[model samples]
Target chain A: MGASSPDLIVHVDTFARVNMVYEVLSVISVIMLLAASLAVLITYNWRVCVLSLAVQYLAAFWLINLDYPLAMAAVKLVVGWMVCAMLGATPVDLKQPDEQLPGRLFRLLASAMVWILVFSIAPSVLQWVPTGMVILWGGLALIGMGLLQIGMTTFAPRIVVGLLTILSGFEILYSVLESSVLVVGLLAIVNLGMALAGSYLMTVSGGLEV
Target chain B: MNAPLIWIVFPVIVSVILFFLSARRYLVVGLATGSNLFFVLLGLLLPIDRLIKLGPWAFEVSSTLMVFGRKFVITDSDAHLVVFLYFFAAFWFFGAGVVRAHRLFIPIGQCMVAIAVAAISVEPFLYAGLLIEVAVLLSVPMLVPPGRRVGQGVLRYLIFQTLALPFVLYAGWVSAGVEANPANQRLLQQGVVLLGLGFAFWLAVFPFHSWVPILVGEAQPYVSGFLLSLLQTVVLLLMLGFLDSFAWLRDFSVLSQVLQLVGTIMVASAGIMAAFQRDVARLFGQAVILESGFALLALSVPGYQGAEVFAGFFAGRLLALALWALALSNLAADGISFGFDHLKGLLHRLPLTSIAVVLSVFSIAGLPLLASFPVRLMLFDRLIPEAVNAVIWVMIGCLGMLMGGIRTMMVVAHSQEGWRFEERLPPAILMAIGLLGLVIIGIFPRWIMPYLIQLLDPFQSLGVLMILPLI
Candidate 1:
């Protein structure tokens, strides 16, 4: 389809007032997104990071479904899970030592600041983008938190996860505005490519250590 | 076969095949270079939608290839660009042999050319941003050699390039809104801002350019040069395409002023920084930044003159960079660090490579009898009448670069009385040819003018400016 097609409209009023079950699931998903994103930012544990990344994607799948079709939403979940798997496998293949937690207080302070900023400006962002409240707050929070993670860390895997989180946030907002199959397919390729490059970088670093 | 199929899919298929055969470096390089040359020949000989006589064969090549409801069209008007890109790829591949870069460079570099071409040719061209990102991703492994730790430069490169994606896509989104509501000043402003930011990041203008010097410092000089050359060319073309596609953007006087201002800053700052740089790799980086500054200057020119200036600057840059990078690569292979101290007396050992490196620097500095001199002279003549301060600052930048080149030459030539020139035949021949090409082009600048003019044909509104009027 041409990118300019007007058929892909978002009925925000109806979408925001979906059935009770979806509403409950969305609430649960938002909480999961926030908690997992916090975990990713605050901790250096590979296991925790991987699990949190997976949970974040699962939550993304539920929230994204509000704006995109089932198939399109599923693509996000599948790609996210695949990326999680690849990132999770790297530390194991390398037999990496447990990472020493550094600057816990600093991380906590930064994460808190980001969360506060995102929540404070969410209403204005919602007005600007005109998407649903759920997506506006959730996507913005993830994006802000991801930027913090990326800025604070030099570790390749952490940076990769941060990139993924940022991309996920964008995908959520973009899904609300346009839903061309071609764009979706291209995004999927991009996600997979990032995952693979991240994995290779981690491997190269691991080999250097040996 | 359609032009898209020939230019896009065929290269991709060949790339994949070359990937498996990458163990044989010579074979991969030969095949990749040969394929690129074949495409150049094809683009020159075949007329789209018209029957061609080839002895026992007569057939017309189609221009459009539709897939997944999107069209990739390469018309006869695009023949010059097709040949330019392929010839560039071939030149890069051929130089890869001299540098002995990793096998992945050939295959991945070939794929990059195809994807970049597709990015420009793809309809609903916003998708070009995504394709460029993919090309960036593929470049990572090649940039970070195997078993080496990934440098901070590569990471920064990734972040900055990724950062551009959203801005570009959003611009496309906002553009749709502006198109629907042509009278909305707010929407027009928003679209213009997003596009400006997007191309700014993509082009690595002054502030966003922290990655260029760093990447050059850490990676192989040859590989980094190839990456810089390819990315800069494609991104500049993409920017031009954006301007061409949007009348509001092209006619915005403020944008031209912004281009001019940014170009001036980049040139002035990069030149000052290059003069103080001790490391040769960083000096090369400065040269790239300077080249990009000239490109932005060209874009700032009024009317179609900007396009002409851009074409000349782009062609000159490719030759200058190839020569510089090849010499740097040879020095690197000889266990030579790019530091001034380390390079002292090196001209005694590798006279040919040293001469090639120094001449390349001088060419970039706009010395007489070199490839870049004509382009620089044209840019100066055009700007002096318009902005004297700009002309003075650009001259200062060029002078700084010339000083840097002189410093390098002095250090390299610091040799004992009994010093001897000893070099392998291949590199010697390559460097000689490179030096000769630079001088010949400098004296006969008009030899390349036809091709540069042809590049202007795609933009119908960009009339043929009096580029190189004296010539």
Candidate 2:
């Protein structure tokens, strides 16, 4: 407890706060991803998972509000939710080892992986590419994600895939043009509306099943 | 911007609330139909100007009006199409309500309204694909049987539609990118191929046409009619919009030729299939496919008149088909099969229903004074010149359609000596409307021409005069 140590303490506290912010955002995103995954696994008993994931998704939104990088993280959470939920609900166990089906599934997985990789390295990739190429890359990546989701057996997945593709295309376009928050906000609203619709269909379809 | 949009929105809101209230109950059907009728009325009364809004993000509404500019035009031509679609939707929706529980009808109708509005209002006009897909999905429950086939038809329908998305997106990309040349030769070629394939898929053309019969064979007749007639008509309107909005599309001779080739193939194949079909429902399905082919063939003929004729023929055929499907569905109820043998004594057993069937089948066959007769004559005239050396193919298709009609009439007209009458005739209103439509449109072909021309104008250049001077 010397007078000189107070300045050092203050510096350490600021550094810790920055680390805490990043850690919290990262944790929030991971939890969302996990929750989305769990929703897919127990989709037969979907209401509880849907409700839980929806809440987790809201918390993720708060994380993104506190930290911008977490916004990009939300896309993965949604995709994870969709893909996992689809796999959980599908009668994949009884299905044969048809090459076409497995090939499609593998392609979907590969596409998702490729998209995530692309997004992870997008900042570095941007430095190497021209504006048009950047837009093209971003669009293709989002589209790939969409295409993957669409390839699934379920209707909810297909609808979600369509919305995601549209979102990806819009996001790429936004990035290329450096669009204003208003456009982004509207786009987010549209995406959210689509998600709500997809969720509603899942509910109705659940009734159809019973 | 127009008050009628309010009319469209308000009823939808009310119906949605009602639908939720009904839950899994039958009340949803009535509320949905009532709401759909309200939407139809809005379309009928709303002015074109009031129906459209022009801005960065525009919305339009009106009663008996034309709201938007020439860039996104909705002339008097759309009146009949809209009116017919509304009533057709209402009729089928009500019929479906009576027979089945389709919770999607209300939402589907709303999507239809959105599609119609978007088609009437959008610029460069390629956005219809997304809206149409939405409509198709909204129609899923109606296409497949509720219990066992709960998701199959809709699933297949969805997959087929998904296939169309990329083709359309590619077309849009091509159109957007190919600006230096208004018509991109390669892009146009790609577009012609893609659109021809895309529409053929939508229309269930030939080899890819399995979905049509499969759906009709399984779903309730009312649902089948809505898909075949009302929903299909909207898709046709969307195609018309695309051809109308883009000068480059209309200018491409290759595109027209492709449409002819596809249309010809479809007619020939579908007609042959229809002629050999044992299922009555499937016969009707095949008949729709053939009619769709004829429409494509008519669209292939180059000239403003050809385009106008195509529009008129499409509108007329849609009305006829809707009536036909409605009658056919009722005829099939009570363990009815599509086989000729099953319908052998339909005349004596179900006289009113038989008559409704007769009117629908005959009208579709282009019987004189029926709604479709004039349209077919006009379509054949245009298609014949384009067929050149292959003239007989078109003839065979037409003849096949006629033969199918004759077969249905012959089968339904006879009464078996020992057969007992059990099934009662459907309500008189359906029969009266079908017969009246047949006779009125057949006798007075000119009655609907002006309105048809107005609808066609957006696609082609039209003159006010009845007959056009050579360009």
TM-score of model 2, chain A?
A: 0.42
Q: What digit string (tens of lDDT, one per residue) describes model 1 on residues B14-124?
A: 999999999999999899999999999998988987888889998788999886777888888887788889999999898898779887888899999999889988887
Tens digit of per-residue lDDT, candidate 1, span A6-54: 4334444445556555766687778888999988876646778888999
Cα lDDT for residue A55, model 1? 91
Local lDDT at B269 for model 1: 81
Which ten-residue region of model 1 chain A has the weakest summed lDDT? A92-101
Superposition error at A11 for model 2 (Å): 28
Give the lDDT of residue B322 in candidate 2: 64
Q: Which ten residues in a row have the lowest lDDT in candidate 2 chain B?
A: B63-72
The residue-level lDDT of candidate 1 at B286 comes to 91
Which candidate has the top score in TM-score?
1
